[model samples]
Target: MTLPIDPTALAGLVSRQIRTGERQGMPTKIAIAERTYATDPDDLWNALTDAGRIPRWFLPISGDLSVGGRYQLEGNAGGVVEECEPPKRFAVTWEMGPMISWLEVRLDPAAEGTTLELVHEAPVDPDMWKQFGPGAVGVGWDLGLMGLGLHLDSGAAVDPATALEFPTSPEGMMFVRTAATGWADAAIADGDDPALARPAAEATLAFYTVIPEEGTQS
Candidate 1:
């Protein structure tokens, strides 16, 4: 199926930021992304948290799905459900292999539709952040949000294989480039050097869109 995505409109809908708050003993940076969905809060929340319906747009999810429960998104992060309140908000501990982070999603009614806010907080890893900036996580969410939009707009399931191949497609590359640039803008807004942020954004774009040479793999 053709990926029905509006890159320009989707780019306009996203807002990003790098927020700092104390986590353990020092300051931690959280990558925050927000966008509005035309659907209502109830519908949006169902699309997000309902395991049965998730694989249609996003990944297949298997989980206990309640406060203090555990969840796994196929081939993605698995985490503990830290908090949950239907149609409003949910918080979880994002655990991937040995790394841990915190994730919170909030939903609210908006003038045009519903506002969805996602916060991914992790202890500052200066080395990685310096090399990639927020685009690393921001672009991933951009894809997920775009998937949600397409699913809601068309009321159809996105073939999982197509979703996996999207980034390598021309339109998908354009979408990711726009998203990575948007993240760079957000980082600049938060006082990161434009010189640094722009390059980091480009690095992120390369990571997501470029195919490695066939002979490079050992």
Candidate 2:
């Protein structure tokens, strides 16, 4: 299930940022990831907004996608589409269990291609943040962005089973470690203590690439 590309190079392609903000009057932590894809805005937009094309790179999604409509990703977050601007931007509520967060994706023309920016904002959980920093979710998005890049380059769907097994693969672990470290660096730039943030990044790496016993949870 190892990707055909250099995991380190692929992990380096993204830019990460950590922002402190307020959401619904509560303190929030925002993780932003940006990368440019080698495709025009129109083509990239279609690949993102088209339901039939979504599962090619990410999870299978179901539900309405228009403004105010609800959508669900299989075994993952489900939320309402809050805004939409074709070939430019879209926003949604990312809800899992009782926790609700905001996710927005923006696309713009870049010198090389179309730049995709993903912003995820959520109310901070002190213990969780202390244990994993932004990489808790940032690393997951990094993996998704990598999948998107592969799909764009190959013009084909990534193998679902392989993707599911990827995190435990040698190359997948390498990619996760690199991306997690990147998130830690971004957090440090945002005022997190370097000593603490580095450990959190290691925690995030373990969370993503660890394989659990057959009868126990991770």
Candidate 3:
């Protein structure tokens, strides 16, 4: 499928970061991704929070979205809205099965446009961290950010079929590979050994781009 933007250029749009931190005294790893959208803060905020608009770029979401309410992202994570500040920021608990994490999204008016920053912090699973680094979640958000950009630019929903097929496509593979490398670099900057981070990035790339055989799960 044809991508709405250049794969490499789209991959470069996000700024990635890794922060070593703690939540409730438990060691956690934070994955940060930021991008500037050529739209006003209000529009960007609406696109992010409006139920009708969410599936256009992100996922099908259903629930009461106000503070302390619950929300589920169809087949993905479900959580409670912890805080909400219109056209500015919001925080939520990101829970998938038994695992729980914290997600905060902030929108700031910038000279060029509105900058969207997503911060995802989860307790570290040492083995998973050693295997995938931040790219496990980072690359997925990279795709979401890419979809948002396309939706915002075209003022329309990104084709769901294309979005689903992207990761294993040649262009999608390139984007994932590039995003994984960027996350690895962020990990390295955050003091993870380069030797380990590089391999972890490769593992991340494989995880995202590998296609499963028919009737099998990925």
Candidate 4:
């Protein structure tokens, strides 16, 4: 299945690569994505901070959501809440086995809506990032934002799996295909070698294929 690509949407968001020194001579690198929603910052904050709303779009998150509080995601990763500022910003440790990363989300108000920014930093194996590229998190976040849009605009509860599955539908495939191309473009813009970006995009598309194009595979 190929998905339609929204180059403008992908390009509008800001993504940064961070390098942190904590592992001997190796450097930790991360990529961030930022976007604005047509909703108030407070509303956006509730959607993220409210545990009940999390599973509707993103993962099933369980945590105190306060500074220094620990949290967990069902069947996924878990870690400690590093920082929290209601209606503004929050940070947490994202742990999956040996990989420990930090994810920070910030919210701000705008004339049209609310601005949402996400930053994820960790010591990634260079080869892994080369294979996954931005789509590793980009696709997931896209689904999350789509759900947020539904909730804010129409009070709809989007099934997380369905949101992810949409990209495999005949129409959805077009979106995924286009999205893959967009990710490739973003990677290139972020200074990834063309040679690396193309393959990385391909790998990301392949990862999504774990669910069959017909939406039967789990």
Candidate 5:
């Protein structure tokens, strides 16, 4: 279904940035992006931390959330909460089966409201990185941020089925295109060759917005 959202205004609500850094003994890189929300740090923190509120915007999350605890997202990754600093920052291990990644989030109070920055680091799989660049993970975060914005604005639970089906929808493709282009810009800013990164952005966009074949799920 097509959502009633302004592609232009929606595009203006957030920004994307990317940077790469090394890790110990692994061929890996990290991507960090920040999105500013028109809300206080405490409110944004609550939205991110409160289990009751999480499923409204992001996914239905369970398990312990304190430092040294484990948390799981319904139908998604579950990991150890490595650090927690209330309304400012949190760090966790994002694990799905044998694959492992690290995710960190920081909130900074700003004139516009609160700036939420997410850092996701994963061991680079040469082939996958070549296929999608930063947008592989960047675009996923973009969708989560969009859902957070919607929930913050309306305080309504998003329909999961609808959210899943969105990317293949017409207006949804427009939003996806905007997100993909933003990531291309970010990659270029990080010194990636545009010849490679731009096409990776397109690959990422196509991956996110393409229709699934009959009887197969996205």
Candidate 6:
């Protein structure tokens, strides 16, 4: 089944910025492209917190979702929920590490729909982040948001793996290519040398095999 939203538009919706590390010897900071969806805050909140709803777009997530509650995403890492305020904000530990990469999501009610904001914060590890990059996680979230939008609008059920495969399809490949370019732009904006950003972004896309073009971007 095809989705109503344009994959290219969804790929381009991300807005990102990078922050220099505060502490001496600390790694640089990484953030994702923030996206806002047109929907209701209450509906958005349910999409994020309800286990039954999560797997439709995102992974199979199992978590208490309450403040200080620990949670896990099947086949992925586990962490604790640091903050949870209904229909407003939710934050959680993303993976196992002292660095404590975290994800924060916020929802604001609007006349047209709910505006959703997502922030992923973590220390920079050139090698690691390059392997995953924003698209790795960002694409996943993009699929999740799409699924949520459909679920709220039409009672549709999306399989996480199938949604993820969207990027590998012909249309999905276009989205992935554009998203890679967008991330490269973000890397450049963050003060990364073009030399570094170019290679990293190419490598990242290659790692995910999302782009179906003849030659690798790198």
lDDT of 3 by residue, 1-218 (tens): 25644688889999999999998999999999999999999999999999999999889999999998999999999999999999899999999999999999999999999999999999999999999999999999999999999899889788888898899998899999999999999999999999999999999999988898999976
Segments in model 1 whose C-alpha atoms lie over 4 Å from true places: 212-218
The alpha-carbon lDDT assigned to residue 5 of candidate 6 equals: 48
Task: List runs of model 5 lying over 4 Å from the truth.
Answer: 1-4
10 residues in a row with least lDDT, candidate 1: 4-13
Higher-ranked by lDDT: 1 or 3:
3
| Candidate lDDT values, in order | 0.86, 0.94, 0.94, 0.69, 0.85, 0.67
Residue 54 displacement (Å), model 2: 0.4
Give candidate 2 misplaced runs (Cα > 4 Å).
Answer: 215-218
| C-alpha RMSD for every candidate | 1.9, 1.3, 1.2, 3.9, 1.8, 4.5
What local lDDT score does residue 106 receive in model 3, on the 0 to 100 scale?
A: 100
lDDT string, candidate 6, 1-218, tens digits: 46644768766666655555543556646565555656677777888889887776666878676788888888776799888889799888788545567787888776778777777766667776656555555555555556676666665677555665665677666666667667767767877677766776666566555444677542
Query: In model 5, what is the error at residue 100, expressed in angstroms?
Result: 1.3
**Model 2 Cα displacement at 100 (Å)?**
0.5
Pull out the clashing pairs in model 6: 15-33, 39-113, 39-114
Q: In model 4, what lDDT does residue 77 have?
A: 85
Residue 7 of model 1, lDDT score: 66
Candidate 5, residue 56: how far the Cα is off, in Å = 0.4
Clashing pairs in 3: none
- lDDT leaderboard ranking: 3, 2, 1, 5, 4, 6
Steric overlap count per candidate: 0, 0, 0, 11, 0, 3
TM-score, predicted candidate 6 vs. hidden true structure: 0.81
The weakest ten consecutive residues by lDDT in model 5 span: 1-10
Clashing pairs in 2: none
Q: Which is better, 1 or 2, measured by lDDT?
A: 2
